[model samples]
Target: MRRLFPVTDQTAAAETTEGAPGGGDREWSLAELAAAYAYPEPEPEPEPEPDHGPGGGGPGVWLRANMVSTLDGAAQHDGRSQPISSAADMRIFGTLRALADVVVVGAETVRQEGYRPARARAEFAAARQAAGQGPVPAIAVVSAGLGLDFSLPLFTSPLVPTLVLTGAAAPADRVAAAERAGARVVVAGDGPGVDPARAVAALATLGHRRLLTEGGPRLLGQFVAAGVLDELCLTVSPLLTAGDAQRIAGGPSVAVPRRFELASLLEEEGFLFSRYRRV
Candidate 1:
């Protein structure tokens, strides 16, 4: 893959080899990818303000959403994102997961995508250990109804215990069912629906500061609306699927659209991977 934005001296040198067989378009190793997408180093902690509680912002807490969309603004094709993605996209996806402490995903996405446990990648084992992280990142599912199949491997066999983020008003029986399946239930909102900011804070309280969300539109919309999203890693596909499909985010429109500045952009086989930070 080739980087297209914020060109560094190293990337510039690689660009000089363009047009040769397997030159600039050569696949990147996991190490290179890791360096390209590494999270910012933790900053010094500040004194806690009076009356602050869990979910209150703190140092090292970053929430980034990873999503894919077509050139015509379709987040998914035929109720799934796989059809609209590429090999390089999957590489970046795995890289993002490897770097995160927890992956926050919406319930519908978990079901639709055949969610599985986040496996420990051998490539990142050393890095993760040095960062004081567990063998693998935890999977945190956001749900209001808690309508999930507890029999799935995602709940039954995670390397790290899975988390269910819901509100206080969720059904008691479902909460019990989740716990029975050995999943940890976290209350992140007062009402039945999850409060996006609270969910981030809840994860933060659990020591998952490097957060990544593989959103399924509505969930991403909630995070965007709550103004808690710190960064976005969006993959722009070259193909266009002109169907009535969900955008990268779905929900009530903000009175003002949020502005984001590009942090990095990479390209491979017509796919554009772009990372943006809130401006």
Candidate 2:
């Protein structure tokens, strides 16, 4: 892989593979990947005991969405993203998951993708401990109806307990079912649907400030529309799938499109891994 944007001396050195035939293709080590995608340092709090509640200045939260799209803007091919993904893309995917404190995903995506519990990666184990984080990031599923198969390993056997984010008005029986399955239920909205901002805040309240959302588009669209998304890590697949498909963000168009600035870009094979921060 090669760094393509905001190239630095160190990152530039990563572009070459010594002793290789062509000397340009190489796999990045986990340390290099982590450094390249490390979260911004937390800002200093003004008060001795900072308040993180609404209107109380706090350490702040960073909610980033990771997604993939084809050259023709298809987020998924045939109801799944695997067909358009590459090996390096999966590497970056794992790195993102490793770095996040929690992963927020929509219920449909969880079911369609056959969700599983986040496992503890030995590569990141020590670093996680030093940072005061759990062995593995928690998985939080956002659902309005709570229509999920609680028998899945994601809910029953996650290294860290899984979370179900719903609303106060969600069906009582369904919520009870989730709790009985050993998943922690969190209410993020007053109505049946979750409020994106509240969901972020609720997770933050639980000490998950480094949030990553592998959206199925609809949930990402809600986060984007709510102005709660801080960054985006988008992978551009070289292939094209021209059939009707959803964009990386799918929902009602914003009155005016939000702008994001490119922070970093990496290329492997023909895929472009791009990171953008809200401008």
Candidate 3:
């Protein structure tokens, strides 16, 4: 996996970042982002408050989803997002992973994108260790049938063992297969598919509150319908693909429109990276 470090908005405008891995070649700035989403300041004598769960002090869960779309609102061109993405987008993507405790993804995306385990990055090591996080955030794949390849490195060799979130009715043999393949099987839903709320609660029980979901449309749809999504980090690619690619939120039509307030927007290589908080 490639590494990415954020540059400030001011610096991005002035000069491209050196040692940058393509994208805008350092034109994208995340400095203002660093300020907007500032990490919690240290407390001299921290108090052990009650387990408020999700937010740890606020409401239910602190769910955030990250996604990218083209100018025409197409998330994928040929069943993949890479064709519509840029290097700057990848920097934000990696940064998001570094900051989260767990990354929730859908099974289809895992297969299509050839998912891999999240490895520890030297750039974010000190920050993570200081925040009491592991070397790398865990990967949680939401699946109904546990259809993922057991032998894949994503399940077999992860810095943190990959979590398979499934429903009670998933195939018994498949569930056993996943466990045998060195994966942690978590039954979070009661029906054929994983329940979004139950999944979040299950993760919360395991002390994973800094949640980030990289959706593949269907999974995102479930989260939105559950009304548990707290934030959305969207990257708008400059290209336009008029094909029938799915929208950013591709799933069943949500009746109630969930609104989010713009937190910040950064630009580089004609890409617009925007963070929106649920309002």
Candidate 4:
């Protein structure tokens, strides 16, 4: 495998865990990772006012998007993301899920990835409980068309009921089918497409304030466009796939460029785990 950079001793020492997949080469330790990528130091601010404003002006949920890409900026090698993933990446992926209240994703990704329900991991059990979180975070799928497979395990067998976000104009039959299949359907917009802002609001109203989005590109673009994306945890796979694969964030190009500040970078087996937060 091609590596963009060599692994450091800190990451190398923490390369494997008991029974974790890719034990021989994976580099992951949440403690070490936290120490490595703690969100950048904040600038001094005046004494903060109470954050209890009315009508969506209050302090809302924080959005963090996790995406993986090749060193050359290809989001995927095939039609799926696993083609460019590593064991270290999977560890970080699970850790992020363990820390979130909901894992937001797009419908296309759900289908393409054959996503299953987020199961409670034994390792994160005590920590999750201490943090007042449920055994597992809920899966929230963003779909404008409501054209999802209601029978999928992701909808029928989740630890928490899976959430389906759609617009008010979505097909009623499909929406009803989703609800009947043991899914929670939330309307985010009155038009055909889901309003990214409203999607965050809906999840927030449900008491899911720590939102994590595992984007399928276009979905991330929507979140970026809405200016609701608060942070991004990106993994740079050390491969060069010379193809027409997409970038991490797709869809229509943003009219204005949005910038995120680098928080930290960690590496193992040539993979660079990076954290960037909206400035």
Per-candidate TM-score against the hidden true structure: 0.94, 0.93, 0.83, 0.84
Local accuracy of candidate 2 as per-residue lDDT tens digits, 199-234? 999999999999999998999999999999999999
- Give the per-residue lDDT digits (tens) of candidate 4, residues 178-237: 999999999999987899999999998898878999998999999998899999999989
RMSD of each: 3.0, 3.0, 5.7, 5.2
The TM-score of predicted model 2 comes to 0.93
lDDT of 1 by residue, 5-84 (tens): 88767667778876422227779888888888888887876766778854433667889899999999999998999999
Clash pairs detected, candidate 1: 55-201
Per-residue error (Å), model 4, residue 97: 0.5
The true-versus-predicted C-alpha distance at residue 154 of model 4, in Å, is 0.7
**Model 2 ranges with Cα > 4 A deviation:** 9-24, 48-55
Candidate 4 global lDDT? 0.82
Cα deviation at 126, candidate 3, in Å, is 0.6
Per-residue lDDT of model 3, residues 1-279, tens digit only: 111224455545444546443233444345433344443343343345578533234223478899999999998889999998887678778888888889999999999888899978787788789878898889999999887789999988998989999999999999999999888989898886898999999998887878999989889989998899988888889998897888877677778788888766666767877778788
Q: Which candidate number would show the highest lDDT if scored against the true structure?
A: 1
Instruction: Show pairs that collide, candidate 4.
Output: none
Give the range of the ten consecutive residues with the poorest summed lDDT in model 1: 17-26
- Predicted structure 1, TM vs. truth: 0.94
**Higher-TM-score candidate of 1 and 4:** 1
Off by over 4 Å in 4: 1-31, 34-60
